[model samples]
Target: MQLSVTLIIIIVTTLVSISGFSSQKIIDDLIFYPPAVTQQRQWWRFFTCGLIHADFGHLILNMYALYIFGVEVERAFVSIFGKYGNLVYLLMYVSALIVCLLPTYRKHKNNYYYRSLGASGAVSAVVFCFILLFPLRKLGLVFFPVMIPGFIFGTLYLIVSTILERRSSDRINHSAHIWGAIYGIVFLIVAANFFSTYPVLQSFVEDVKGWLASF
Candidate 1:
């Protein structure tokens, strides 16, 4: 079976994440330490850090979300972009890793104790990209069991993430999530405009408008 780009990424991330669980050196080397980037100029940490996770639960959630949204996003990109479909998808995922970390790097460039590891930023980019593609699509929480429009869900997610980021009470980088999601939307809109001539933002608005008319 030919593995898709999404599956390939998941396989590599899972293997590396599992290894990170057993080896502190692996984590230390691959994990995002802003000081490493600022002082040592280890720029690759911006991207490599996303290949490992803090734990199995974190790994699973990020990869699961990636698979759920990535498959569809890949297909959509193909439909809109023709031969460059997979290429654009890959670019978005990889660039999202770096783009999503820029703010974090700025904030923690000298915070020697600051370290982050996970694919959350890239995965958030994928999820938000999918949300833009299908604004009317219904999303349901794992616990709440109530289905809501993708745009609405995305809105709530950004709001909650912003609030949590302000609190700064957790190890998770909520700021990365916020920036990742914003980058996702912007990336898709810009890519569509320049590469495919598709009015993605307009399409999203039309989809939402149609959904609103149904009520």
Candidate 2:
């Protein structure tokens, strides 16, 4: 059996992230250091940084989220784009790692102290894309008893991420999450329009409308 792009990403990211846990050099080289890119022109860090993570928890959470949603998203892409689905999916994931971090790069390009390493941005892109494709799908929290639709969860996520990003109280890069999600939605819409004749936005709207009508 052939390995899906999602599984391949998980494997590669997991191995590199685990290696970085013990090797500072590995993290130093792969991590997104704005100064490094600004000074040394190591722009590859934008995409390579996703291969390494801050820690085990960070790696696991991102990979798990990607696995949970990426497979479905891949299938959806295949359905929409035919033979080129896997390629498109791969491009989206890699490009998201860069696009999601562009704002951070601009803000910290000269700040030597700023460094980030994780796949949260790309994972958020995949999760948000899934939510866009299935807005009415039920989403549940770990400790919460109530389950809400995907769109509601996405909205709440964006709101909380925005507030936290504005506060700048923690090291978490919430800005990346916000941009990645928006990029995911836009990527799908544009890809569909350019590569296929599918009316993706129209279909999403119809799905949402049908779900609302049922209430």
Candidate 3:
């Protein structure tokens, strides 16, 4: 957990510094949306945009959430998948990004001017993984300070994202966050069931279950 958290912090800080050093205008182009049909085209921006942030506050808030949620998820992954845990996490992160971007890319193929940024997609992966691993656990919102079941929080987040996506001027990339959560929940459920039936995987899972039971 400590190692994973440290690596994430280092990666986020490095990306933030790179964004600051890049031309100010370049930051706008790299933000999760392609440029207008009239502007110069850059296909790699889809992946690079996620590495930049709108501000220090934005980066810190996202990183904080990632740190809080990602550590537990990594532990769960390692308990279930052993040495392959990091690979699974990486795949989930990349898959969520691609899945979230595909629809936007397809819809704005001509205009290519829509834009987004931040670590919301990766954060969503961690959040939803927590929801999956500990669905019955309680969580409290920072703003509301109201305690709620993890499953309820996860469901409400998805609903809110869907509603927010319809609004025209909303700056938040709620859709990506929602889809990323879905990807994490589905991936873990499927992987857990598939691995539970295998000899080695089942042994690891049983050991994890025993460890959890002891707690």
Across 102-143, the per-residue lDDT of candidate 3 in tens digits comes to 566666666644677766776787788887777657787788
Residue-level error in angstroms, candidate 1, position 181 = 0.4
Superposed by TM-score, candidate 2 places the C-alpha of residue 202 at a distance from the truth, in angstroms, of: 0.9
Residue 65 Cα positional deviation in candidate 3, in Å, after optimal superposition = 0.7
TM-score of 3: 0.78
Q: Name the regions of candidate 2 deviating beyond 4 angstroms.
A: none
User: Candidates' lDDT values, in order?
Assistant: 0.93, 0.93, 0.69
What are the C-alpha RMSDs, in order, of all predicted structures?
0.9, 1.0, 5.4
Off by over 4 Å in 3: 25-29, 35-43, 195-215
lDDT value, candidate 1, whole model? 0.93
> What digit string (tens of lDDT, one per residue) describes model 1 on residues 1-215?
87888999999999998988999999999999999898899999999999999888899999999999999999999998998999899999999999999999999999999998898999999999999999888997888889999999999999999999999998889988999999999999999999898889999999999888889
State each candidate's clash count: 0, 0, 2
| Model 2 CA lDDT for position 150 | 91
lDDT of 1 at 106: 93
lDDT (0-100) at residue 116 of candidate 3? 74
Q: Residue 116, candidate 1: how far off, in angstroms?
A: 0.7
